[model samples]
Target: MSRSPLEKFRTIFKRSSSNSSRSNSTQSENNSLTMGGENYDYDEPPLTPLELHGYKSTTKHRLLNKELAEELRQHVPALLQISHDWELLYSIEQSGTSLQTLYDKCQPQIGESVNRRRGYLIVVQDTRKNIFGAYINEHLRPLDKKIYYGNGDCFLWKLEKGDVKDLNNKHQSIEKKEVSLNLKVFPFTSVNDFVIYSNNQFISVGSGDGKFGLWIDSNLSIGASDSVDTFGNEPLSDRKKFYILGLEIWKIC
Candidate 1:
C-alpha cells in the first residue's frame, strides 16, 4: 500500500479550498446577474428600444396570445353556423370551465342532434286563431301565409292585410294570415304536426301508413295545400307506424 506524503496531501487540500472559493465567487456573480445588478455584463449587446422596455418580451408574447384568443372568440359564432351541426357544437361551450372536457361531453349531443337534424323549437299557439303551423325567416319574422292542418285536413291562409285584432285581449293577436286554400291531407293518413324550415322546407307529421309526409312552401302567396310535396306525395306506402310528434328548427348563430 503506497501512502501519500503528508506535505503533498496538505498542498492538495489547500488547492481544493482555493478552487471552492473561486466557485463560490462565480455562483454569487450569477445570482446577481439581473439588469442594474452588480454582476450584470454591460459589455454584452444592448437591447433594442422595443426589447428594452421592462418585461417587454414577456408582455408582448402575452398580448399576442390574448389577441389570438379574442379573434377566435369573435368568429366562434360564425364558425358554429358554418358547421353542419352548429347547435351541437354550441352546447359544448355552455357548460364552461375546463375546455379539455368539451369534446367528451359534446360528442354525444353532436351525434344525436346531427343524426336527428333537430333545430330550434317554435311554439305556434293555436290561440286567437289555430295556426296549424307557422314559418319564419332568418330574422324570425313570420311569413305572410300560415298553414293549418286541423280536423284531419290541410289548409293555408295569409296574414290578414294587417295584423289581426287581439282577440285574446292579451294586447296582441298571436299571428294573423288570411285564408288562401284548403286541401285535405289526401292519401297520407292524418296530420299530427307540421313543420316549416328556413329554406322553404315544410314537412307534415301525423299518424298514417308508417311514414310522414314533407311538403315545401314555394311562395307566401300560396297556401299549404298548394305547396309542392318535397317527399313523394304517395311515397312509403307501407304502414311504417311513423308519427310526427313535434317540429323543431335549428337557428345556427
Candidate 2:
C-alpha cells in the first residue's frame, strides 16, 4: 500500500519545525535593530537644578546720581511730618516736654521745629548737618517715596524768616551743597551702621574712620580736577588725585 497522505504530511511538518523556529529568531533580531537603535534630536535646553528666582550675573551697586539724590531729598519733609506724628503718640503726657527737649538738643546742629497744632511740628529749616554719615534730623524714607518736582528737580523750602518765594529759593542754594555732600556721605557704614541712600558709586575709603571716597558725577563732564584732594585730605591749592573707588562713571545711567 502507498504511504497514507496524512502521515506523509505530518512527517514533512515535523522536519521543517526547526527551520521555522530559526527563521522566527532571525526576524526578532532584525526587529531589535529597528526598534532599539535610533538617534533622536533634543528640542529644549536642559535646566540646572540650582537657580535663584531673581539672580543677576553682576552684583555691583548702581552709581548714585546727583539728580536722583536731590529728588530723594525733596520728599523727606512730608515724611518727617509723618514720622514726627508717630513720635508724638509716645509723648502724650508730660506736656510733651521730653520730646521738645530732645528736639531742641538735636536742633542746633540739625533744624528747628515749631509746634503746629497738637502732636505736630512744622520743620522750619533743615541744617544739612552730617552726623558720621546721616543728615542729622533729616528724616530719610525708602527710595520709592522720595519727592520730586518738574524736570527731576526737588522741592525744598524754609519756613523761618522766609516768604514762599524765599523759602523756595533758599532750598535751591542749600540743595546743591547738601546734595553734593549726601552723594559722598550716604554710602558708608559699620556693623552698627547701615547706608540709607547707596548709589554704589563710592567706596568706603576709611571704614574704620567713617570716611568714604566718592567721585563727583560732574567729574566726567568737567574733567578730573587737578587742583584738589578729593578723598581724605582736605582740598588744597595743588593738584591731588581724588581716590573715589567703586565710582565707575559708566555705572551712571
Candidate 3:
C-alpha cells in the first residue's frame, strides 16, 4: 500500500517509543551546559587589612569627637553660671555667727522673688587653704537621718589656687574673664551625701576628731543610696577637719 505525501511526512517525523527516553536525556545535558554548569554562584570580594583598619579607626574617632562636643555644649551654660556665682561668693568676707548667717549676708542681686525663691552657695576652706563649695537651688529642710540626699538644681565646684589667680588677674576691662576652670558641675543626683543635714543644711568632712563640717539652709536633695556617687566611696564624714569660710544664699528669680 503506497502512502500519501502527508502521511509519509508524519511517519518520518514521529518519535519511536524506544528512542524517546534517549532524546530526553540528551536534551537535559544540553540545558545544563547552557546554564553555566552546576556551580554558578557569585562571590563578594574580601576586604584588605589596611582598608579594615582604616574603617575601624575612622568610626571610633568620629564617635569620640561627637561625644565630647555634645558634653561640652550641654554643660556650657551651667558652667558659666557656676563661675559667676563663685566670683560672688569669693568677694564676700567670711564673717558671721554661723553658716546660715553668712549665707543671709551675701545674697546676690537676683531680682524679685515670685516663686519659691531659694538658693545657696557654700564654701569650705581646709587648713591647707584649698577652697571648694556647692550651689543649691532650693530651701533645705532638716533631715532626721545623718545621711541625706539633695535634689533640685544643685552643683558643686572647686577653686584651685592656680586657677583662682588666673581667674582674678584677667584684664579688668573685659566684661567676662577669659580664664575658666576645668571644674565640671556635678548634679545632686550624682552624689551620695549631697546635703548632709540633721537640724540644718550641712556637709560633714572627715571622720575622727579632726573632721570638719559646713552648715547652711538651701533646698536641695541628693540621690538615693543606689545612685552613683561621683565624688567617691569615702564618706564626706571621713575626711580631716575643715572650716566653713563662706556661705551665701540667693533667691533665684
Candidate 4:
C-alpha cells in the first residue's frame, strides 16, 4: 500500500506517458515488419521542454503530458533514459485500437549489425483512470505457440495521485496548487523468466502461478492486473479486471 508514485519514483529520476479503447474492428490483418510504417507528421506545436526534459521532437503524444512523462522518466534505467528521446510507435488514439496494430507499429528497428536495441514502453490507462504498463526489451510478436518473449528489462510501473491541496497565493488565489505526481517501478524480482508473453490470443507481462501482473486481450478493449512473482507489483488497477480506456507504446530512440 506504500508504493511510491511511479513506486517510489518520486525518489528516483523524473518524466512521461497510458491508454485503452474499444475498436470497431482490427485495423490490418497483414503484419508489417517495418518501424514508423508511414510518415507521422503532426500539425501541432512541439511540447515544451517542461514535458520531455531533454529529448526533443515535434511529435505530440496523446496520453503523455509533461508531468506524467517526467515522473515516469525517473524510474527508467539510466542506459535507456540517459540521452534517448521517446518516439511514438503505436497509439490507440493516433494508430488504430487493434492489438495487432501495436505489434506492427512497434516492429524492431535494430538490425543484426547493431549492438544496441531500443526499449519499448507500453502504457495503458483503464476506464477507472489508473495509468500503468510495462517496459519491454523487444518488439511484440504474437506467436503461434504459447511462450514468453521478452528479457529482464521488462517491468511494470504506474503513476499515482500525489497529495493535492488548495493553493493560497497572492490576491487570495484558490484555483491552483502544487500537485504531486509520483511513480512506482517494480523491477524483475527474477522469480521466473516469464517477463513477457504474447500470442495471437493476447499479450501479457509478469507471471507467477496463474496470476499476471498485467493482461490485455487481443481485442485490446479489456485488461486485467494482478500481483505476480515476476514483478512483485501490486494490483495495477483498483479492480481485478478493467476496460481499456487508452493505450500507447513509446520506443526509446
Every model's TM-score = 0.18, 0.16, 0.38, 0.68
* Candidate 4 weakest lDDT stretch, 10 residues: 164-173
Alpha carbon deviation, residue 164, candidate 3 (Å): 1.1
**For candidate 2, lDDT tens digit of each residue in 40-80?**
22223222222112112242222222333343343333333
Candidate 2 least-lDDT 10 residues: 244-253
How far residue 14's Cα lies from its native spot in candidate 1, in Å, is 89
- Please give the lDDT score for candidate 2: 0.24
lDDT of 4 by residue, 171-219 (tens): 2222234466567899988878888888877889997789889999988
Top candidate on TM-score is 4
Error of 2 at 89 (Å): 23
Report the number of clashing residue pairs per model. 12, 0, 17, 27
lDDT value, candidate 1, whole model: 0.26
lDDT of 3 by residue, 113-172 (tens): 535344444444333334455555544444456655445355554444443332212232
Model 3 ranges off by over 4 Å: 1-95, 103-118, 140-149, 165-180, 190-240, 244-251
Q: How do the residues 101-187 of candidate 1 rate in per-residue lDDT, one tens digit apiece?
A: 322332334334433322221212122232123212212222336553323222222222223223222223232333232211232
lDDT of 1 at 62: 14
Which portions of model 4 miss their true places by more than 4 Å?
Answer: 1-61, 109-114, 161-178
What is the lDDT for 111 in model 1?
34
